[model samples]
Target: MAFHTRSNSFPSMPHPIVQEVDEHLCRLRSSEAASTSSSSICHKLSGLQDLHDCVDKLLLLPLTQQALAKEQNKKWTNELLDGSLRLLDVCSSAKDAILQTKECFGGIHRRKSLPISLLVEE
Candidate 1:
């Protein structure tokens, strides 16, 4: 016996409110392209767009902002850490060079009572 699987998917449909908003936006653009446009109409449409954007933001998952902030903070932290590590490596190299210089000249001490500056001058 063969088993049959049923399809549970539904057809996609545009939301009525979304369709209305799109029509309103198209009308606003068309009016703007037509002869001298009134600034007040443009201002109202701008405000409406801003309100729609705010509503869209409200619908996003609560953790989205926190995740974006965390990602940016992590990027900044990595940059600071990388810069500190580079500086540390430079310091380590300088210390090694100084130590190697001292080691090379230690066996050929000309004056036992002189400071390193005087010994170097000698």
Candidate 2:
């Protein structure tokens, strides 16, 4: 079988999931510097969760599954599968980390009278 390289050009109109992912990423980037409060951090984590959801939707589409299944090259498919798995893993880890941070921060934020050292001692 002959192997042919495909063009990397994107369609004139991006897929809806692609657009969603872009929007979430742009929002996250724009808010990065202004994330000083717990609410802001929660909002950013929500955006990350939205991006992860977009990826999950994209991967589950029949067209995407078919494309991966039909690929003649095992290497490309393997890499794509591996990359997707890694992406999901990172997203899960990030979400958990953010939630833990929010909890700890919120706890300390709620206890305004306590010193930092006192909070740590507890």
Most TM-score-accurate candidate: 2
Each model's RMSD to truth, in Å?
25.0, 8.0
Give residue 71's error in model 1 in angstroms.
Answer: 2.8
- Expressed as tens digits, the lDDT of each residue in 15-120 for candidate 1 is 5445555765666666665543334444644545654554355435354446535865788657755765675586566557656766766755646657778767
User: Clashes per prediction?
Assistant: 0, 0
Q: Report lDDT (Cα) of residue 61, candidate 2.
A: 83
TM-score result, candidate 1: 0.31
The C-alpha TM-scores of every prediction are: 0.31, 0.56
